[model samples]
Target: MKAIEYRLPKDFDKSFIVFQETGKFFPCPWHYHPEYEFVLVTKSTGRRMVGDHIGYFEEEDLVFMGSMLPHVWVNDAVYSSGQATHPADAIVVHFLDNFLGQDFLSVPEMEEFRKVLRLSERGMALKGRTRRKINTLLKQMPPMNGLQRLSTLLTIFDIMANTQEYDLLASPKFVQNFQYESSDRFRKVTEYIMQNFDQDISLPEIASVASMGVTAFCNFFKEQYRVTFVEYLNTVRIGHACKLLAENDRHVVEVAYECGFNNLANFNRQFKKFKNMTPTIYRKTLAI
Candidate 1:
């Protein structure tokens, strides 16, 4: 389950990388790279795994990921069988943190752009009008060069930074665990969590997955992710509960227990804290 650290292709003449991918399926496995990445899936339906987050994805899926963040999109089984009716397509952009010069983003004019970069550590799923704007610019980029290319890119960043229509992909606490992923320990932790998050995940158990004593693990996790181990667990459990509440017909209490929440009261409280709504209200919104 260890993720591959990917290396981007180099071109001596280029300042950044912008390209399109068309295929029967998205082939890259769970992987990480140093360059910040922006991607738009124009045609496909699948599930996306970003950092500690797991969720479904489909056409118009647009995401921006920070340097060294891990991500992947696994297409549905129909695409895997090689008998798909339509080819998959996507536009991807890659640039280094200092691609625009170390001080470029520090300028006051680039303040919002800086925030986009910082928030990208958790990844961002662009939505609504912002996604539409970026999609249009990306389509216009391939045929343009020099200032045209550069200006369009800046515009895309501006839209992303100013727009409110986006979802942060991963929890701050969970992201730190991936900071030092050279060792397989981070990989093991992620794989173990994804496989077993449905059941109760205790601090001691998850700490063992990271190969550290519970106390040492606590210190390490806190320093790395800036969140206590228990808070991270609750975030994961709550995220799972949200999916079930929106997509399944189960009773609220049943969804609570199934997502590893101990009692109905606690489940309701955490759901409200995490989602700012009750389970029934969340379900009703989904129905809309």
Candidate 2:
């Protein structure tokens, strides 16, 4: 989907905004904003799209997105259609890079924070102990004011900067080439891939979508996405396979085929390459 630029409400009273969102479903479309966002889903089950990455998310899902990163949270039909009794709830904080002043993060003492901010450009999924720690802190933030609130945010950043329990969501090329205009070639290719990744997409077919020959399109895709077309396709398929495995009581072979893999062995190999675990093991972890 094409991402629109979303302007967040400006708050003159505070440098940042922290509040809880409770509703039948999250209503934001695929969009980008200029503020860095820290969001924790306390109650929900759905898919999350950050740049070119697509994955399933549930309660305690914590993610940090840098300024202008494209993203969206799509609730499952049960929640969005109001067929479920419970509501979706999340704690979200939004702040600009210069929220504390442009010079604040430029200081020598803030070097680690600078690195963290740069890494966040790809969007980040916090996991393991870091996710748990940040979840606890965010739950306490909505009621805090002034220095207490600011300090809490800094503490969360510090924890994130120091931890290795996180995954970068978007590819480097996606972060570098994303533009708000929908007619751009990169956007078109991205849209095509996202919409058709579940089907058998040949290089020539996608090249035609981009109005290029197979060889030229392959080179262009690699240059624009920093990965071979086939590799990128497998990555997307494996990512979706992860969601299916986590959310469905399906066999590994079934999930693989559903994700566009023609053979179980290739699916297992590619899934391991991206996720570092077998599908069965990954599903078991979710059960745990």
Candidate 3:
């Protein structure tokens, strides 16, 4: 398995910046940076892996990732599988914690904004009215510069602070693995799992992909991802099941089989264990 690689910007001096990307195949491997990032998926649909979070993503999705949080957005098979109409489109903003200076957060006027940035450590998604507002701001991002860009960013934070619809993506225990220097290993493991998640995955098989012995691979994967290979496979399978439940009109048993679970009872058990709801309940919630 190969590691995930990211195409970083050429200029690294700026602490805060915003830019637009279109039709670029930058498979940013599971990596992180010192600066926090805000990404708006203006035109794309794919799977996102941020820290311990994994799920499908579509157009208009807005994500904020804190500094040092490993993440990546893999284009769906429809796109990378050589059938895409157009490449992914995105507006990305990156800024350091001190880009606005220490005094900015200390000021009484910016207390709410300060809190929002702190909460962003786990990653967040903007929803509903706030999403619409952010979309408008991002559409005008190309023309904005200097103070205008700074102000627009401030307005984005303000909107996020006031919005009631936002959810954290990563768990408290899902800390960044700074020691995982070789992103190739991470990318290879994940891509293999994503591609073969519908089949029975075994430690020996995955270890072979990593080209290491079973015990060595187990320790290495656990150290890097903080989850055993089997556990992570289950997470991916359950995530696929969730998507199938919401988007497909298949029977529960059929969905289970398609998602790689051998039996309906085992699928239901795992789904409820991870989602806290049965597959039927999950479908019902999505319908509403």
Candidate 4:
């Protein structure tokens, strides 16, 4: 649901649009719109899809997505099932490319802001000191008006332009051309994976989620992603495994099973295939 379903700042008022949203979980289905967006996740953890990339997200995640990039912050399904003890919350900011007029950013004084806009086209994740600075500015924005609001917005952009403490989210080559049918099908399949990736899920059960036979679903999914469904599931598991490994001194074998691998040897082999390192070496180097 989009367009008429969601309220936005009225057209012709071009300063900026900022607000706080809270819910059982992020409810917007995987969708895209023309506004460039910056979101601060104050609470919740789940999968985030940007362009063709899929990955887990957690609390305090701050990200910028370019106009029409097709993305979603899908909370773990339990949140909607009344299993999550707390609700989700976020501070969201949005604006158009030419909100200040087409020529405003072309001026020499706005050079850094222009660079930020360009880099943000690939999507961005602000981390470390930059994220801390933004979190402050975001909290300070809602009560301000007129010149104060504009000033706060400029300061936010200026900080983002100057910082090296950010990572781009999507690949440079990634392009998403939306097909509603495919998005709907994958939504079911991916939600199933994200909700149950730690448990053993049968291929037939997963195929049924998309209303396809196992062979057809396997072939279709592989062609779309260029990796088998099992491989993709392993990648997701390995990602969570890396998170666990980084957070504590969990033993490698235990981490493997915690992430859905049936055995230590198999987990090691898959981890090596995806990450080019064994679990022991991975946790030791833990830079991700």
Candidate 5:
């Protein structure tokens, strides 16, 4: 329920923000930033939302998110409950498109890298050898000098530019304007929704949390996120269902009930609508 909140350091003048994470399940609510991001997960597993794409993630996962793409790392409940097998570890890098200046990409020599960065608008997953190399680079970031940092960043970008294993994560419709005011509102609303999404969440209930009336909240949500409140709710439910279906062999009806759908029929309908497949099929497909 904390929403997708991030803390920026005061007077942080560098073009990029870099850090390593461990221990906690930092479940950032769905939100976007104007800057691009590179993240390498060292140890952990959970549901990851990058743009419109949702999937399971495990150790050594790496991803690159373009400007204005919404994402979150929802750690498993075991981590939240302090029973994690290993502390979660991640190296995060964030920088603006113009961090190296507009002319940086204008240089004829950098065109290929420019196209690679553009492809990131849909988000990308980094895998295999590239993941290990990036992890080593990120681990060395904190102690590096300005020139060293630039060298490392360029190396990371070069690898990403040439890699063929990456895939786009979000759909085209998932793009949204990256305005601070709208993003703030979204953070608040999404936090409230994630916290109480498993229960009966009404428009009035969420609207109050956003400090807006129901009508205003509806318009605000749609305008900012391009999805109705109901749509978002169903997305959240389906996300929870996905986690359950993948992690547990519980009966389908039980998973439906726990995901907040009152009846199996409605749960099935909404799940199929969002997933383009039924829950049973989804589970079975994962099995095979």
Candidate 6:
């Protein structure tokens, strides 16, 4: 779905913004802003959507996104219900690409960082040791002021530029054609699918949600998202299935039905197609 544009609160005291957010749930809707972002989920379990990528997130999850990458973290039911033991919390940083200066990244000293920034255009899931290190640095950033904060930010980028412990999040196809257009129909269709993905939704039903005919909706969805509507729906369902499997020892057949796949064999086939492992193997690997 095309994301709505979001404006971060301006902080004139500093050239960038860094702070900790804690609440019953994360309140941001699916949206994008014109600044690079660093997000560390300090305390939460949820699903995160980065461009065309959808996946699970848990405590200490770290992601870096460049300007205009649509994303949001939707807390799990427990946290959102306000019944969890602890509130949701995260460390979030937002900065313009040229927050230092218009010509800063052009300097020779920034060559490596420039490369990392380019990679960030596709969004990145910082992992392993690099993820741990950046999480620590982000937790320390809110207290510092002036040049000290800027220096720490640069250090984080330097570490990221040098480390291979990361995975690109969004697909290149999605990133290449994404625009900041405002479309209510598009937004409504996406929201409908997300909210009702666990139920069987027919083509006519979803197209009706977009106020379009079946053929028109199919073409529109493909043009906007670079994927068929069914394809995108399956991606969401499979992502949620992965989350369910990781969080518990649910039987695969039960998970399949819960994720809106009525046929167990088809669910296994789709799971293997997207995750590169059978559902059983995928769950077994987690036990390791």
Question: For this target, which candidate reaches the highest TM-score against the unseen true structure?
Answer: 1
Writing each residue's lDDT as its tens digit, candidate 3 over 1-288 gives 123434356345544778887874435666777778888888778877666556567999988887777788877777777677888888888887677686666778766665566556657877888888988897787787677877888888788767667766654335423232346876687678878988988889999898889999999887654457777677677777777776778999998998889999999998777656788987875563
Ranking by lDDT: 6, 2, 1, 4, 5, 3
Cα lDDT of model 2 by residue, 195-258, tens digit: 8888999988999989999998898876544468898787778767877776679888898888
The predicted structure with the larger TM-score, 1 or 4, is 1
Model 3: weakest 10-residue lDDT segment is: 172-181
Q: Global CA lDDT of candidate 3, please? A: 0.74
lDDT agreement with native, every candidate:
0.78, 0.82, 0.74, 0.75, 0.74, 0.82
Task: Rate residue 271 of model 2 by lDDT.
Answer: 76
Cα distance off (Å), candidate 1, residue 217: 28
What value of lDDT does candidate 1 attain over all alpha carbons?
A: 0.78
Give the alpha carbon lDDT tens digit for every residue of 1-288 in model 6. Answer: 347999888678789989889999999998999999999999989888787566789999999999988998999999988999999999999999788889998888887777677667768889999998888889998888778889999899789878878876664434543332338887687678878988999999999998899999999887664468887788778877877887899899999999999899999988777666788886775564
- Give candidate 5 misplaced runs (Cα > 4 Å): 1-7, 10-13, 176-288
Per residue, candidate 5 scores C-alpha lDDT tens digits across 147-217 of 78889999887877666766555543344432233357667776677677778998898998888999988
How many backbone clashes does every candidate have? 0, 0, 5, 0, 0, 0
- What's each prediction's TM-score? 0.66, 0.65, 0.59, 0.58, 0.59, 0.64
lDDT of 2 at 284: 74
**Which whole-number lDDT from 0 to 100 does residue 70 have in model 2?**
93
Model 2 Cα displacement at 246 (Å)?
23
Per-residue C-alpha lDDT of model 4 across residues 1-288, encoded as one tens digit per residue: 222224376435546788888989988876777788888888888877665345567888888887777787888888877689899888888888787889887788877666667556557778999999888888777777767868888888889777778766554334323222345887778778877888898899899998999999999887554457887788778767866776789788888888888999899998777656687876664342
Task: Tell how far residue 144 is off in model 4, in angstroms.
Answer: 2.5
- Model 3 TM-score? 0.59
Question: Which has the higher TM-score value, candidate number 1 or candidate number 3?
Answer: 1
Off by over 4 Å in 6: 177-288
Which residue pairs in candidate 2 collide?
none
